[model samples]
Target: MRFMVMVKATGYFEAGIRAGKEHSAAKDAFLHDLQDAGVFQSAEELLPSSSGLRVVFPPGGGAPAMQAGPFLPEQEWIADYTVIDVDTEDEALKWVLRMPLPPGQGEHVIEVRRLASGTACALDARAQTMKADLQDQLSLLHP
Candidate 1:
């Protein structure tokens, strides 16, 4: 199973100021361990939401409205994330629990969600059977 571990926090354009570069060593060590275990796929740090844009779609279908960040509700900010392939959710949680904390960061909120890899990856037998049936119907529609 592949899990996406996200680190969520509320901060401004200056999240790095208090986070401190000194913690990079600890972060690097954690990454090294993940790589050594052959579970790490990738990791990334997201920039402030102010650099993003939001598209709001109207009901029933119409032109969408575009709004630029910084968005409100600071609680929605996700600072960074990592993708890892593990045997089970418990194993993934074990790894996430060891993730190093950013300097000056108080409590961190992390979210772990399994990726929908493919028909054969994480889907149950029933889901796979349904997907196969759907594909058969779609093929007939085009042919």
Candidate 2:
């Protein structure tokens, strides 16, 4: 199973304050532990919302709309995420418990969610089409 562990954003993150050395070291150590355990797949911190964009689709089949960000409701914003492949949810939870808190925090939140895999859903057709299209594009670039 694959799980995504997301760190929620705060006003401090929006201000672009970097993580303190101690906090960074702690996080690095945690990541190293995950890698050593053979569960870590990927992890990264996101840029603030000011540098991101949101795409909104219309109710019908009209064109999609794009909005530049600085999106509010800090609780809804994501600061960073880690992806891990583990045997079960319990194992994933154990890994999350070891994650370090954000630097200089008042309160912070982390969310964990399981990801869908393989062709086990109603959207499998669409997903396969997109995958084939991507492969075709990549082949064109390489050839």
Candidate 3:
């Protein structure tokens, strides 16, 4: 099963940067262990909400508009994530449960989903179409 484990940030996470270095070392080591176990596919830590952008399209045919950070109804902050491929949902959850978080600081949200292998015919057709498109683009660029 493939699971996208999301680490929800709390106030303490920001506080940690100011609080000191106790949890930082443990957090880094825990991430390393996950990589060593061959269970870690990818991980990324996001910036504060104020740095994000929200894009929305107009009701008619107007172009999309972008708004700067901190959208309304502030809820749980998404801090980081780890995508892991495990044996089962249970296993994925187990892995997520073991992830280290700033002590009493943040919430860990684990979303597990069974990976799907799409129809071979569909994939093959898409690949062929992409190849044709790429060739056309290359010809246009070169010619």
Model 2 residue runs over 4 Å out of place are: 119-143
Q: How much RMSD separates candidate 2 from the native structure?
A: 6.8
Maximum-TM-score candidate: 2
The parts of candidate 1 lying over 4 Å away from their true place are: 12-18, 119-143
- lDDT: which is higher, 2 or 3? 2
Clash number for model 3? Answer: 0
Write the number of the candidate with greater lDDT, choosing between 1 and 3.
1
* Residue 17 shift from truth in candidate 3, angstroms: 4.3
Give lDDT tens digits, candidate 3, residues 1-143. 45678776556553335324766676678778888887766678787666778788888779999988664435566777777767777888777667766555435454455546442232345678999999999999999
Q: lDDT of candidate 3?
A: 0.67
- Backbone clash pairs for candidate 2 read none
Q: How close is candidate 2 to the true structure, as a TM-score?
A: 0.79
Clashing pairs in 1: none
lDDT of each: 0.81, 0.87, 0.67
Best by lDDT: 2
Q: After best superposition, candidate 3 residue 8: deviation in angstroms?
A: 1.5
Tens digit per residue, CA lDDT, model 2, 100-122: 98756668888999988863343
By summed lDDT, which 10 consecutive residues of candidate 3 come out lowest?
115-124
